[model samples]
Target: MWWFTQGSCFLPFFLVVWSSTSFILSYLIALFRRDVDVLFPYISDAAANPPESCIFGLMTFVSACAGMATIYSRFKFVEKLSEETRVVNPQLNKTTLVLGILSCIGMCVVATFQETAVTAVHDVGALLFFVSGVLYILLQTVISYQAFPHESSITVCRVRLAVTVIASLAFFPTVICAFFVKQTDLHRVKDSKDYPFHVASAVCEWVVAFSFVCFFLTYIDDFKRFTLRVMTELG
Candidate 1:
């Protein structure tokens, strides 16, 4: 109730907490079940088993929904700010929204189709989610810079830029290492000759995932300044 009255800021905060909890809980469950090795695991590896898979799927679905809502709210907020500041960029705003939507859809796809079950589809979903999500944040950072002094602060813009850059840096290694990792067992990659590559990829995947979470955390402060409303007209 307080969150409803205060502002849409809570959306991003909720997204961060919920998404982080989903991954952590899933990881712990997988570890407890011995479904995955104690070492670094690809996010999908942690959720590929029976019990953890079920929980991970449900939790990730909810997180994806929250992510979509947060992205849409940010899009609308930026659109309003741009109008007020006379720094119109409707095309960019729309493009960001499309990217955000596609990324969220990818998240849903990943949640619905487990990597162990549907490997190809799952990998595609992951690629879609990671690439589109990174591009979305990068575009948002650009927009933040564009709105500087008028609708946003230089500090916030810089922070976003840093997060985007880190995610981007992590993204490349994630893809590259995973490509090189040759392992028969998905759950236990430590025995493989390419174990180092697997470790690098898994670690980088976690970094990119958490970086996406942190990016949403940056939205909390800006979202606090605005509220969303739905209006109805009687015809």
Candidate 2:
């Protein structure tokens, strides 16, 4: 567990799993409590309610940890790439790292500001997370391609690029629909049926989340050696 926590690649893996599972469990509990409407309730809605609020809060906190760790891992990986390509492009690397950190901050903000308590702030956080995520993936995809042109994992990176692209495309439309529906007072009405747009948004949001997680899987190959190490410091 310590290896998983401290390892660069493994940290992201653990975080992805932890965050996803925590949110799912929280959502289920929220559903049972009937605090959130079943059909169109956003991910934030589950975290905002009772009985699952703690779980959701933990998820967000863990997400913040993952985000910061990811920034570190990215910086290290970029350094390695510089050695491989024999080219020093600090500007590009810095940009990718900055965007990654911003995306992480956005996620933390989302977790901190629930849709129920602060709708606008929550929306801003979501926007920051998703938009920065898209930019990070796009930039990293290009960097990975350039950095590892001869490596076999480049193919895998390309595949991840495809997934990120699809997720980004789906994310915008669904989020737009979800927010548009929010403006109609459907979410506020107690007796309203589940709105399709909200449901779609929820589904797409999950896809976006999973897609982003999948993007990080490629890093495992890069950092597998770190996992194999039992200790960073030897006596």
Candidate 3:
């Protein structure tokens, strides 16, 4: 259809909107239910209980799937560009795809395992999701630089670099503060001695997560000019 032919941009756009909506909606629900403090709560804390848990799980799972599709499409786009430009490293392109896929898988794991119900598993999932996601974007930024003045503009590269750096800088504090946070009660985190650490970690987490959404937003223009097609053959 003509719409599909011109709608490649929709993938990244949907991802940005959908993932942001999932987080925001879950946070609002948690706040309304008093499941979490009005102060900054860890992303997981915001969706740790039902029925918010159920909503968060389903929404995040769909977002993860959309993320996977968007990443795969990106991989294909870069591969095609490489074939045309001969400037892109084939190995790097493949590696980026692997990292992106792993990140999406991590997102799925995070969605499936609720932190309060399965703390260890959820933490592992969050680790995988955040670490891999950050690395994926960093690699993608490098790729964008490599494609510079050819398939990409200097301004676009700078924007991607900025986002990557912000996410990377926030990541360390998010992890460190989260580790030192001794508040076991999510609702009473603000009342705990470790409240500052909890708030710091949560704020950093949100920063990193939104950084991801902003990074994907940069893909919209590139995606706009590229369209995917499926071919079937019986041999």
Best by TM-score: 3
Ranking by lDDT: 3, 1, 2
Give the Cα-based TM-score of candidate 2 against the true structure. Answer: 0.82
Candidate 1, residue 223: the lDDT equals: 86
- List runs of model 3 lying over 4 Å from the truth: 1-7
Q: Which stretches of candidate 1 lie over 4 Å from their true place?
A: 1-5, 189-191
Query: What is the total number of backbone clashes in candidate 2?
Result: 0
Clashing pairs in 3: none
CA lDDT, every model vs. true structure: 0.89, 0.73, 0.90
Looking at model 1, the pairs that clash are none
Ranking, TM-score, top scorer first: 3, 1, 2
lDDT of 2 by residue, 35-56 (tens): 7767656677777866587778
**Please, what is the TM-score per model?**
0.95, 0.82, 0.96
lDDT of 3 by residue, 25-137 (tens): 99999999999988788888888999888999999999999999999999998899889998789899999989998888888888889987888988898999999999999
Q: Lowest summed-lDDT stretch of 10 residues in model 2?
A: 183-192
